[model samples]
Target chain A: MAVEITVKGEVMTALLSGEIDHHSAAGMREKIDSAIDSNMPSLLVLDFGGVSFMDSSGIGLVMGRYRTLQKLGANLHITGASPQIEKVMKLAGMNRLATIN
Target chain B: MKIVNKFNMSLYARSANEGFARSCISAFASQLDPTLEELNDIKTAVSEAVTNCIVHAYKEKLGKIYITAEIIEGGILRIKIRDTGCGIENIELALTPLYTTVGGERAGLGFAVMQSFMDSIKVSSKVGKGTTVTMKKKISPRITVNG
Candidate 1:
């Protein structure tokens, strides 16, 4: 999936499309890491409305991001996830780590 | 019996999981009314289990991972994933939600994901020997479409 970033003040929004699996993790890591480092956003929002499929690869990616944000004491939110993607997000207990909208 | 005619593959721990196992599994799975959704389930299950061995089981060490697949007579596909590495200290504890050796936001969802994706999942582990996971899924009946 492709990730597009929109930086709004201290909040960075990540718009994702396609599938988020192992194949897509590298790109995600690079994009999210760069956004976090360069923007130093107070919050990171992952928008998954356009994503068609996701699996544990997506979970691992989000968890890695959550860890990075945790270390920085920043907030994270996920929005617009499809039912399948949302099922995975909820299964990963992302609700405890980040806001789900 | 054709039980012995199954597909056997043994791959190095480092190379086995690079998403290759998942791809192979998808290739071998029956295509009766199968969709991208079924393929995703199989891939995700294979990815999580194989990844556990590659990323967590060996940790910093090197080892081998074994994967076997068989298509049964009743349209059931069985996959076995095995690794010879440090086993779980406590199988029950390890399977607990929110518990993971990786820590630091691991979220302990690998097993959960595997369980959710596969029709049936079984795990066996020995303290210092290794862990084995058996997953089974059945192919749906054929669908007919006409103009």
Candidate 2:
């Protein structure tokens, strides 16, 4: 998977692409978490426009990040999730915790 | 149990191999001409089963994971994932949603996801021996046949 981060004012958007499974979750988490810790952006956007496939592991990734951002008093926004990916997130009850766009 | 088709293979229990295992199963299942949703469900179930072997069973140690898929009568796909590694001591606890031994490292939803996606699941294991997860899904035929 490829992850790209861009900062705009107080927002940091993480553009993630490719399949997300257990193999990539931990590494992806570290990369995204470190960026959030250092930048402390007010809003963190997880853009899934490029993501092609994602399994339940993706839910854990989103949940872990939500906690990290919450600790830093930052909000999480999920955007561009394909319909299939959106259903997985919703089934995992992620919509209750983060803003899905 | 009459099977029309079957495939089985074993691969190393490496994190990198999880995707490979799942895609392989998905492609093989495509022979049944399952709907896209059914294909996704099968892929997700395979992912969870193989991931369990890599993460909990072997804990990064080199091990072998076996996968067997069968196309039973009526387009029922049955997949069995086996691993010869450390087995779960408490099967009940492990299947509980939100219960994880690795703390925050995992979401503890692997079994839940498998159970959700597959029509039936049977798990057998012995401490220090290994664990075997068998999941079955009924593939809804997308094309109807008229005689």
Candidate 3:
């Protein structure tokens, strides 16, 4: 999996690609967490446009980041999710925690 | 009338192999010509089962994950994902949503996801032995109109 982060003022967007599974979740979490810590962004947007496949691990990745960002007084938003990815997120009830578009 | 097609594969229970195993099963099930949603559902369920083996079964060391896919009559797809590593002591608790034993790392939705995607699921495991997850989904035949 590949994750690229971009900072625009207080909003940090993480563009994720490849399949998001258990193995990739750890690395993606660390990368996003480090970015959140260093930048202290007011809003974090997870871009899932490039992600082809995702399982429950993706839900954990989003939930973990939401918790981390909440601690830093930041908001988490998810964008660019494919229909499949969005369904998984919805199934896991992640929509209740974060804004998905 | 009989089992139309079937395949059995074994791979190292590594996190990286989870995707590979999922693809293999999805491809094998493709013969039934499932829709994109159906295919994605099957793949996601397969990923969850294999992931359980990698994360929970062989926590400290790498082991093996066994997978079997078969298409019987009436376009029913049956998939079995098994691991010979440490099995679950409480299957009921394991099936509970958001009840993970691995302390904050897992979302505890593996079996739930599998259950949602497949038509039926049967889990049998023995503590200190292994776990076998069998899931079945019926694929409907696609229709084509004459031009």
> Compared with the true structure, what per-residue lDDT tens digits does model 2 show for residues B25-124?
9999999898887888888889989999988999868999999999998989999999999999999999998788886657788898888889999999
Over 4 Å off in model 1, which ranges?
A1-4, A15-27, A48-53, A64-75, A79-84, A95-101, B1-5
DockQ-based CAPRI category assigned to the predicted complex of candidate 3: high
- TM-score per candidate, in order? 0.79, 0.94, 0.98
Model 3 stretches with alpha carbons more than 4 Å out: none
Candidate order by lDDT, highest to lowest?
3, 2, 1
Q: Grade the docking of candidate 1.
A: acceptable
How would you class the docking of model 2? Answer: medium
- Model 1 over residues A5-95: C-alpha lDDT tens digits? 9998988999998767655666877988998999988899999988876767788788888888988989889999887787788777778
Residues B1-147 of candidate 3: C-alpha lDDT, one tens digit per residue: 579999999999988898889889888988999999999999999999999998899999889998999999999999999999899999998999888989766888999999988999999999889999999999999898899
TM-score of chain B of 2: 0.95
Model 2 stretches with alpha carbons more than 4 Å out: B144-147
Best by TM-score: 3
Q: Which order, best to worst by DockQ?
A: 3, 2, 1
